[model samples]
Target: MLRAQRAARPTAVRIDGIVKSFGGACAADGISFEIERGTIHALLGGNGSGKSTTIKILAGVYQADAGAIEVAGVRHDARTFSPRQAWDAGLRFVHQQQTTFADLTIAENLAIGHRFETSAGGRVRWRAQHRRAQQVLDQFGIDADPRDELAHCGIATQTMVAIARALQGVEQGDERVLVLDEPTAPLPPGEVRLLLAALRRFSRDGQTILYVTHRLGEVVEIADQATVLRDGSVVGRLDEGEIDHDRLVELIMGKRVQAVLSQHTRARRGDVLLECDDVVGGPVRGASLSVSAGEVVAVAGLLGSGRSSLLRLVAGDLRREAGAIRLAGQPVDFSGPRHATDAGVAYSPEDRLASAAFLDLSVRDNIGIASVGDYFRRGILNHRAERRDARRLLSEFWVKAASTEVPLSTMSGGNQQKALLVRWLRLHPRLLLLDEPTQGVDVGARAEIWQLVRNAVDAGAAALVVLSDFEELVEVCDRVVVLSAGRTVAELDCDGLSDGVLEHAVLSAERAAA
Candidate 1:
């Protein structure tokens, strides 16, 4: 039966012995894999493991040093392949970054590469273009007006528009491949489900998909096959029958990683470091929680369940509508993040690129930007002192970079996150607010991040984290405060918490309200 299925579907993408290098460093070292036609294949690996390099080779962003690529029975030399060649071969890509022009209307964005009807004198047929764009949007079940600006729509809608535009000219029976690189990275959990459902519908219609993500749960849910990459090599491949959470992690990490969070007993919980009394702001409604000094507390909930909102409220990133916050027995209302920071509070938001990291600046600049006053003397900027401080912080945080002066964009997501954390950790804030601290990070970096959080607590700093991964909550947190629909539901100690128990508590809360 398996042989029959293989023979029937044929191969959509075949990458043979692809080798790509940059300045004596091998990004993809003789890697190879085949994505079957009409199936969703997951590309899994850690940062610096060559997942992006291989995808770039496929999308024509990087020319392979040596290898051959075959798409839909048409072979192309890796050395000569370009992005245009890949596109002409029916390979489409929707990368993690937004590709649509935010200022342009949906119809105009769709008509980017291929414009609408034009008159002999060179006038664009606006009405016809809008109608055609609407037809495509309706076909994909995307609810948006073609005449509306793309910026007005949500990220999920913009993603669907990008995908629809990619598939505009291709026919149903054509052997087309769509590579979605972390498409759901910017979306909420509810939006993620919607995108996955759309991918399933596409697969049912015989469209091939290459799904790249750090979320293993998503892989198990949507992928028909998975190719695990480690150190620029194909470690293993699992068919639908072999894919599971533990097995996939083992393949990616090359070991049986303990599935649960680390079990460590701290000395003891200290005094109440931070407190929220009936806080209501953003999506949070009458929520209450507290973090004791030297303790790591996690806020647990589903998306839109007020987990992040609660953190933002405490961080002063969002304005509180009612209720009060107290720090060490003193009631306080912060005017903004700066006021909070001055009051011994630090926050790391989930969207690192947008909210946290300075992508255009150097690693040293990003690290030392927060504490520049420390190096200042007589109001004169001290470059030498700043560099010294940055070097020390980089070494302390174990941030992997070519040099401290290198652009923050040169580092991987994990290293960038470490830099951001180090920037705040250096402040020795009394309270730390981390929202999805390890959202897009890999396993190794995750261990390092947890260790850093624990180190902060050890130094008498309290931590209140918001994490979507329940296992992580079980591992690093001493206690978890469960929120349901913007209200604090239950507080469970992590000392004896199991994954099943934590999941049940959250789900039961969700269902109870439903």
Candidate 2:
């Protein structure tokens, strides 16, 4: 009877007055929302908007301070919900970093999360496991051999395997809800369409999904219901017809903002500040582009098309095998990043927590560590001057934090990115190399970060950025350079560039290469 009741319920999940706080900061303040069964519901918000906190609570990663959640018509205390309970309640999660082993076979990857079929004699049943894996793959429209290694599959296939593993055993009338947090962040444009199609198929077959992403276009295309959260509270809820780019942005930002990057106006281009000719390094083969002072050029391409490798070669992080680089009309070859830094070139990598930021260090230290010599006097470090500059730059960059003395990890992802930018922008580099500068950041911080880049470019610094978000690339860039299979395939002016135009340029390059 209880199973029948759960199957009959229209709503899949419900949150009532969910509240979570950390160190006196309320992350989620009495947030309440409902997700109907067999629908794609998007939980939209900016960085530090409490949507993450709410998801963490639902996943049992963090116990809420107060509230309750109803899963399949069964109410449970939020504070005592464990991960085991979530799994038992038919809740599954596929995070941005999927927990699949690249070296394992597809069948092995599938069996890792669930149990493997075994005989009473304690022997493994490989055939049964392979058969079940093949069934799941076929069910999700994944075309791959179950016995093949997952590493041999494309990124889209790997992601589908991850999703299939997550949705294992979650069938019709199961009242299951799959939570996908930025699943498409690591995927390229072509792969994103493949994943979204699979998701829509699941929804059509009675699967409920809670999709969290910063990409508004995907939300518009896939979401059936939209719940916007701001500063830990429910701001607005939009039905399918109500979800559009402008309306969603207005609700997420709590203002009638025209667009996320609507405020950007192109800056005047000066003389060519940095030039690359036939650059060949790592995966970048014959990649070439030029950036002028006060100009922003963006690299757009599919994954492994050498977008990042090109940036690394230009930034002196990778060895240029066969290419000539000219900075200010002077031929230059940098041996390392220090050489680049000394030569007025600043580069910020994509991974902040791993490469850029010192999580254990204070914000002041993280910003000042790169240029500690500026604070030196009488053969001793001057802490006072460093603190002063840190505070000034924090304010200048619009990094919101309690104080400059707090640990860098205490701040949000967006602030961490801004803080890193503050470090580079303070150096006054003649050319800035930014690879996915706004990759993980939310829309609000994304705007602020681009604004900062523009300020630097306006101050005579040339910027070459690699952005996967084509909309942002179209908005913030002065020119678009398309790369394919380690080659510069096309270059388009951003004067009238649309997302379709940019994507078509990239796709056309890939298709031609194929």
lDDT tens digits by residue: candidate 1, 1-514? 1211223367899999999988777889899999999999999998888899999999888999999999989999998899999989999999888788999999999999467777788899888988988888888889999999998887789999999988876676888899999898766555677898899888877889999998888898888889999989999999887889899888877888773347567438899988898999988998988889999999988777899888888878899999989999899888877888999999888887898788989998898887888887898999988888788888888888888898998777888889999989999999999998987788777878888888889889999999877766788999999999999999999987886799788889989978
lDDT of each: 0.86, 0.88
Candidate 1 lDDT: 0.86
Write model 2 residue lDDT over 15-107, tens digit each, in one string. Answer: 999999999989999999999998889999988899889998999899999999999889999999889899889889988887999999999
Number of the top lDDT candidate:
2
Error of 1 at 208 (Å): 1.2
Minimal lDDT window, size 10, model 1? 1-10
Q: After aligning candidate 2 to the native by TM-score, how far in Å is the CA of 347 from where it should be? A: 0.7
Candidate 1: which pairs clash?
261-475
Clashes of each: 1, 0
Q: Which stretches in model 2 have alpha-carbon errors above 4 Å?
A: 1-9, 119-123, 260-263
